[model samples]
Each structure stands twice: as structure tokens, then as C-alpha cells.
Target chain A: MPAGKFTQDELDQIYAFAVDLGRKAGDLLMERVEQRIDGSDAPQTFEEKENAVDIVTQTDEDVEVFIRDAIHTKYPTHKFLGEESYAKGESREYLLDAQPTWCIDPLDGTVNYTHLFPMYCVSIGFVVDNLPVIGVIYAPFQNQLFSACNGRGAWLNEKRRLPLIRNPIPPMPANAPSQCIFSCEWGKDRRDIPDGNMHRKIESFVNMAAEIGGREGKGGMVHGIRSLGSATLDLAYTAMGSFDIWWEGGCWEWDVAAGIAILLEAGGLITSANPPDDFDTASIPDVKLGSRLYLAIRPAGPSATESGRESQERTVREVWRRVRQLSYSRPGA
Target chain B: MPAGKFTQDELDQIYAFAVDLGRKAGDLLMERVEQRIDGSDAPQTFEEKENAVDIVTQTDEDVEVFIRDAIHTKYPTHKFLGEESYAKGESREYLLDAQPTWCIDPLDGTVNYTHLFPMYCVSIGFVVDNLPVIGVIYAPFQNQLFSACNGRGAWLNEKRRLPLIRNPIPPMPANAPSQCIFSCEWGKDRRDIPDGNMHRKIESFVNMAAEIGGREGKGGMVHGIRSLGSATLDLAYTAMGSFDIWWEGGCWEWDVAAGIAILLEAGGLITSANPPDDFDTASIPDVKLGSRLYLAIRPAGPSATESGRESQERTVREVWRRVRQLSYSRPGA
Candidate 1:
């Protein structure tokens, strides 16, 4: 499908459908919230083989199944890649080919939901030949809906267009230290491996970020570090410039698929843990899994040439170079 | 002043005064927001000082002066310790004495304010003989007011009591790994640091935490780390049980003064960065300056026996031991 082949009316219909589905999911979540509040349902109850953490509630399964069924029934010709159905040894061919496919994560922050933290969301992305061209993220808790359609620009809550902030980011003084904030999982892998390299890499990254951004050198210290426990929300916050930089490891594609589209559309940059051979859409999948690292910098004004996008890229690369060699091994490995 | 010395009527008046002051300061901030939105006033600007981040805003100074003046004029007998004045060499003796004194950080989380991040607050605490007996923290952006009296429970918005979660925390399994979360400043002190030991400490903490909490560990890994940028709000959130643990260095007493009172009142614990010390009222100070560290933990569940506290204490000690030997030295050092 060529870029201009989709007419404006078709795009509008798709946008409306996506928004409706997002709202439907949010409404279901609200219903669940009411059930929990009314004691009609317990949010989590154990079943055999699945730990409480591993168990997906009926809401999770039902929501995903509903979306998949609805989409497949409505658009039988379209391909689908969803979180719940992907683990049955399905091939990635749909995503590999240049066909239009829907990538959906019914719930982006599941732990938050289990704990009732109110930071979770429903994420949906439309990909053409593996490239995200339409993104919809609905955070029911915050009543925030962020959507973008390639060249149409992004919108918050359908009415408010997200005008990109174009303020000039002051040039970071030469020799000025830089700061970094990274997020990683505390997976259940501690026991089998006594020596943890992830620990070393994190230590190195924090130390270097602080050192470069701290007081002993020409640059001021890095601002600080934060781990919010939700990748989608983290990426969303980063895209809005509430945070300066975000680095991460050990996250799945669903965790970042919709967020990646939003981040890229917002003019933010995303790259692999290691420098990419080329900075383009193709680099996304490689950077999505936990195997690769990601460095995302919020967009800055072009007038501040020295410390603009290029400078930020160089700074990130330098920070990566300083800590890249630190080895990390999984416990069993 | 003894607990019963003040009549119920007098106590009511004091509460009213504190609440009014908080609201007034909040209104001033709201005005600033409107002005910024209307393009009538510029957002607060931030500058880097020697290893420190500084924000110069009329709101901060104005709010501080307004609070101090109102207190002084109304209760001239009461002593006051505030941030802006302290920077100009105010005495710490007032805070040390047993007399009723006020500790205030008119604009907590100034960095958030400068960046329009919506996490800043106005914190006010009342201490009699160094024991924080009253606390009022108001976050205008979120319209949240966290308040508490010595014997009374904490409240948010004067209606909802603290510890919003209704469910009991699950028991800690015997096989549970040692996992923790910490919050700290990336102070403006990077200029003199050469080796980036601070970064190393962060890497070490994150790695250790991840290893202990990550996959392959018997017990699940620690949840994650977060930095909200304001000690007052951080401590308040801890008191609310939103975060299990908090550790911070490079902040002042006013920042944590009110929050400390609220935490203790809520049955949480706090100690200096050194081995776990008593978190009794006597141990808290009125003002803490550069190079101080703190550890705060919300009380564990009924299942946590004396042995459980002891085990948790030992783990914390081990973490500190690893962290203590590490330091980020200035470039020349």
C-alpha cells in the first residue's frame, strides 16, 4: 500500500474506529473498577500453573479477544498482531511483510492494573510493512487519549492538537557534565545468577551520567534518575519533555510499539542500545526487545545548533561509549 | 507546649491558619500558571550553580515572604525557619529548641516549578521541642493537601485519610529476595568529580536491586526506583504507602520537615544514611544541609515479626556498606 493510496475519508473512518475501540476498552476497565469497588469481583484470585503476577484477568483476555474478533470480523483482509495471541508459536511474517497490520497491547501496564495504580492504558498502532503510521494510546485513569496519524500531527483528547514546543534549548556548554535517567526490570532472575552484569551496567550508567552532569567538571551534574515501572507511560512522559532522556533495557515490543510511534511523531529520537547502522524506521524492531538498549532524546530547537539534536546525539553516544563495555549476564546464563 | 495545653478551640484556629496559608500560597501559584498561559509572565528560569541547580522565581521568594510575614505578624512569639532566609544565614537554634517553631519550604520542588512539571508544593510543619507535631503539604497543581496532627491520622484534601489502599499488603514469602527503591539528587556537584563514583554507586545499587528482584531470583525482584524531585512530596508519598522505600542525599531539613512528621505519624520509619538509627521524634532535625543521607521505610505488615525487621535491617545495612565505600570525587581530588 503506497502512502497516498489511503484516501482522507478512509483515514478518518479508521481514526474514528480506533477512538471508538479505545473508549470501549476504557469503558470495560471502568466497569471492572466498579465491580472491584462494589466487592462483586476480586481483582486477583489464583489459578493453577499461573502465579498471581503471571495471571491475566478475564478483563485482559476478554478485552484483547474482543478487539481481535471485532477487527478481524470487520476487516477480514487485514492482518493482526496482538499480545495475547502472539506466544502460540506464531510466525512474525505478517509484521515482516509490507501488509497493513494492527499491533495492539490491550493493557500496557498490567502490574499497575493488578495493584490498581491507575497508570495503565490501552495501546493500538497500525503498521504498514512494519512501520507505524497510526498510533492511539488511551490512559483511562488519566482520561488522556494521545493519537497521531502520520502527517496529520498528534492530538490529545481529539480536540487539542499537541503543538510541539519549539523553545530553544540553551546550548549545553562544552565540557559541561550531562545527566541521565534509565529504567530496567527487576525480573525474577536473581537466584540462578549470583554475579549480575546488568547491575554493573546500571551502576556504570548512573555514575557516568552523574559524573558528566555533576559539579566536579565543566558541565553541571545530570538532573536525576527515575524508574516509573511502566514503559509506555515513561516513553510518553519523555516525549512530552517532562524528562530529559530515557534509556531502557528488558522491555517487549508491545511495551513500546504505540509509544515509539508517538515519540517519533513528536520529533523525539530513538536508537538502539548500540549505535545504529542507520537511523530509520527499520531500526525500531531491533531496539524493541530487551536484548537491545534504547536512548531517546526530546526534540530541541534547530537554532541552538551546538546543543541541538546533533549535540544531544553526540552526548548520548559518548555516554553509551563510556559504559557500553560493561558486561551483563543473566543469572542462569 | 503539652498536648492538652491548647484547648480544642485554639487547636481549631491553628489548623485554620495553616490551611489558609497553604491555600493562599497555592492561589499565588495558580495565578502564576494563568499568567504563564496568557503570556503575561515568563516561566521560572533555572541556572546551574557550583554542583547545584538553582531557580530564581518571584513566586518562590514572594511566597516565602508572604508565609513568613503572615506567621510573624499573627504569632510573633513563634519562631520561624524557612528556605529563602536560611540561604541568607538564618540560625538553626530555633529548630533545635523545644519551643514551638515553624519549618517551611514555601516552594518545594522548585525544579519542577521552573520546568512547569506540576509536582511542586508548599510545605509547612510545626515542631515543639524538635518533635514535628503538625504538617501541611499542599500541591496546588494536583489540588492535593496532605495534612496531619500528632495523634490524628493523615489526610489528603481534608477528606480522604491517608493510605488510600484498602487491601492489606501480601505476606513476604520466605524465599523473597532483598529488593529496594531509592531516591536521590543529581546535585550540581559534577564539576569537581573526575571518576564518576556517584555513577558507579547508582549502577551498583540498580544492579544489586535488579539482581535481587529480577527474574531467576526465588523471591520476586524489588518493584523499581523513582525520583519525583521534591523531598516533601517524596516523603509524603512514602507516608501514603505509594512507595515502599526512599533514600535521599543532598537536601535540607525544611524539605523533609513536614514530610517526616507525616511519615512518623503514619507509622513509617526514617533514619540517617548511616546504619539504621532510631526514627523517634528526637532524632529528626529542623534543618539538614549538604551531604546528608536518609532512609525511609513504610512499616511492614503484621506478618513481619521482629525477625523480619531484623532481616530487612541487615539487608539495608549491607546495601549501605557497599554504597558507603563508594564516593564520587571532584576532578582534582
Candidate 2:
């Protein structure tokens, strides 16, 4: 093996380290949660970034630093990136080189964590030359540990194989619009564009298929739209078929790298939320993990029958079409 | 005790019975889930009532019948009200008389169950006359059992006290609109109303307080909006301070009956989702539990200080105001 370039065996070792590190980090975070629940401390002070909804607490910083130090002690020359320290010196350019980089989100759902919502998680993604090679996501409250290496299949708690591969990859919906559960996250960006703001886009998107006086061919009227306040878990569970569709953006690379590995291994597909009209899957075989825009679909699950596969394809196509109709573009996009 | 009413011992026995029965019912449902994962059965058929979202599968009926028979054999005089049996000459009127009765949702969050959302549960509520006297909710996947008997206090797993109540009764949020976590459910009804529809109302409600760029005061932008798909667990967790405010409607009485008993014991408050402008809490200390529209707020926890008390009151007032602003109404109302 080259001095700087590690083989797949080395990558697997790092993935092991990440799984343990993530579980420990998750324990520290949940300990603080218990503290908050016990009223051991007064209300926490959170520093707002772009908006009130986009805030970070001290635990987030502390957890990130701990993870960074731990990684440094293990791999001195390896680069590390975290959400809290993104701009100090580290940037995407650091990930552009042919070196192993550790992309970590010490806390993916900060808002959910502070509010005592159970959807928060610890996400760590190890990328090689900007390619996500291994991912780990730990949801403490749910006691779920999801991890995947580039080629190895995803696992929940390191036991069961995912997609459980029942009928197909993503579980087919018994029915769409009314019987399917979809996931949507209201990201940190509260900016309003010419097309529509995030809030506006969500309202319109929900109204399109929802029963608005039986509005004809307008609403996706999906069984429901759920926002867990955590992007990593959203992708993780979507990969496991907890949700049929997951549409997310306005977050950075660290938030999704680990999830991307898991989702792909679980047989789910990812595409640009806003794709060109004649989008060719053959050409765009992979989604730009750093572009900050993503639409994910779980491959049909065990419920998907030989007959249902045809309908599932049509539904996936229609959902992709609707994603385009929403026209939600962030300033960065 | 009166002729038709039970003594304290009788109530205790009934509560114990419900808890055990609920756990067993939940187990059966989960076993079926495992069977599906192991590919042991053909696709099950579901019957739709009002719409596709309003569905009931054979398992629901089977579970209801099992519970009903057990209760009937134990206490033949006690009436039973269940979702699967509601249309067969059963109604809240069965619960209106002074006779002891059982109100049950054999499987709550049915849609979640079918889609493997992991938020569904088995809720069994026991009532005397019109009052919710005993409540039990079992989440099989999470292995959580929440139960409460009036004035007996609530227990999770029959061990720990909930809210852990740190400050006072319900923990006060640092800010109502920006720091609180809220729960909202879209029921089975998909009718488009004159002023948009339930789907539109929900979108507006979520966006009104959700973070939107430059929308100013129009958006309530509360910390976030979450939907559990199961009214029972939503109420059970809200009672435990997992959710700050839970606004729900368009479901039946059995859905919220068990939650009502649990929330009241937790020192939480529930009012009509749309309260009259001049509604006086001093005069009407207790909310009408049968109302289809309901809004619940958690009381400060064991840490509730005099200063935190004031903030808790303010946040509750603001959440109530938002509920009224949304103008959510029930078909019965």
C-alpha cells in the first residue's frame, strides 16, 4: 500500500472506529439530554447562525471538538471537517484532494436535540478524494446504529441486513398520496426566492396532493409528510424503508455523506430534487453528494410484487416530476 | 362506591388488566410484523371507510374482537367501544351512561404500522360514565408502556415518573414560537373545504410558525412540527413532555380517551383546539374530553421555578393563540 493511500482494509478499520466513536458521542449527548430532562441545568443558551431556527448549542461544539481530538489522536495526518468549525480554516477544497478526510456532524439535529425531540443523531462520514467511502449514524434516543462501507451492505445495529430486501429494495406503498408516508425537512435557510421560500414551497408541495376540496391533479396527497428535524436519520430511515420518499436540501456535505453510503447500499436511489426535464439516469448515475440538493426514493420493499414493480417505477417518475414542479432553489444552488 | 361505579380496588384491578391486555395485543401485532418481514404471508387486504387513508385491515378487527371478548368474559356488564366495531350500533353514547365501559383503539397509527413507521401503538382506555378513569398505551416496537389511573400518577414501564418533572409540572420553553416542539396530525378525512381544506389548514398552521425567510410576524415559526400518525402515542408522549403542544382533530373519541387520563395526571392541560376568545380557565378548569378538536400543553417539570412558571404560562398562552389563529374545526363541531 502507498504511504498516503490506504486500501479498502484500512477503510473498514476506520468504519469500525467511527461506529464506536459515534456510539460514545451519542452517549455523551444523551447524558446531557437526561440532565435537561432532570432540570439539573437552566435553559441552555444557543447561538443563532442565519436564523433563530438555525441555532447551535454548546454541547454541539463540545461534541464536535471531542470527536475531532479523538480522530486526530488516531490518524494524525488525516483531515477532519465538522459543521461547527467549517469556516475557521477547513473548507470543501480540503476534501478536493486525494487524501482521506473525516466529515463529521457531531450533532445532526441540534434543534431536535434541544427541544427533546427524539429524531436527532450523530453522523460521521469518511470520504476519500471527495467520495464517501464509509458512513455511520447513531440515533441515541431510538437506540439505532446505522453504518455502511462503500461496497458492504448497510446494517441496523450491526445485525440485520437492510431493505431486509423483502420484495424489492424500497417497500412499495399499499397506495400513494393517501397511504404512503413521506419525509421533508425544513432546513436552516429561511430565505425567500423569486420562485418561493422554503416555507412557501412546503405549503404548496403539501397542498398539491392533500385533499384541498378534492383539488384535481394538484396535490401529492401522500399518506402524510413527516419532518423529523434530522437530515441524517431521515436519510438513514429512508434507506431502511421507514419513509417512502425523502426530499432534503439547504444543508451541507457532512449532514448527508454517511447517509448517502447507507442509502445507496440499502438499494435506495438519490437524484437532484430539481432535475432537468429529460433527465437521464444513465448519464447522471450518481448524485452530487456536495451539491446540497437531493431527492431520495427507497426501492420497493418485500411488498413490491412482480406486478407492483411497474407501478412503483411510474410513481417514482411522477414524484420526480413533482419535485421539479416545486422549483425550490436555495441561494447557494 | 355507587351501584354502577367501582371502588378504588376495583379501579386498580381494571387498570392492571388493561395494561397487561394492551401489552399482549401489542405483541400479537408486532408478531405479525415479524411474519411479514420473514415473508410468511401474502399481502393482507385493508378495507377503507371514509377514504383510502381511513383504512382498517383484518388484523385490526381480529385484535378488537380478542380484546372485546376478554373484557366481556371478565365483566359482561361493562360496555365496549372500539374503532373496528363503532359502526355496528356502538358509539360514545355507550360511554355516556354511568355504567363502566371500555374505549379502545385496537391499533392506533394504523398507517404507520402498515408502512413500518414505528410510531404506532395499542391504546386501551377504561371509562366510568363519561370520565376517563384508566388509560394504557403500549408501543411494541419501542417496548414502552405508559399507563395512568386518575390521581395515581403516570408510570412509564410501570417504573419511572414522567416529565421526570424537573421544574414544576410541565417544563417551560425558552421561547414558545422558536424553542418549542409541536405535534400535528392529518386525519383520514381528505375533503376540500370552502376555505381551502384540512391539508391546506395544516400547511398554513405548520408554516405560520415554522421558519420562513422574511415572512415576518405572519409565521409562528415554532421550533418545529412533527406527526406520529398515531393519536394515542402522540398524546401519551405529549403527556410525558416529549411534545410541547399537540393539536389534533377528525378522529373519534377512543383515540384521545386514554391520552386524556394520562395527560391530566401529568399536570398537562387540554382545551378545545379553537377556544372561545373569552374562555376563562378559572371558571372552566377541566376541558371537555369528548371534543374532537384538542390542544394540549405540558406543565413545567420538577425544576419549575417561580420565574420559569411565568414563562411557561406565556408560552402556553401563545400556543393557544396560534391554535385559534389556525381556525381548526371538527365536522361534529
Most DockQ-accurate candidate = 2
Give per-residue CA lDDT, model 1, range A1-333, as digits (tens): 323356666766776787788788877776775565445676354221122233355677778888888789877887887776764444433233467777788877665565454557888877665566677888785577777776666666776444223333333223322433333333222332434545544444445544443323323245555555567767766555555566665455666667767776666677665544443222233343333356666544444346466555655555454443323222211
**Candidate 1 C-alpha error for residue B35, in Å:** 4.5
lDDT for each residue of candidate 1 in B195-283, tens digit (9 for 90 to 100): 45354434345544543334332122444445666888888876765665666655666787788778776656676554324332233
- Per-candidate clashes, comma-separated: 56, 43
lDDT of each: 0.59, 0.71
DockQ of 2: 0.46
The prediction achieving the highest lDDT against the true structure is: 2
How displaced is residue A120 in candidate 1, in Å? 3.5
TM-score of every prediction relative to native: 0.78, 0.88
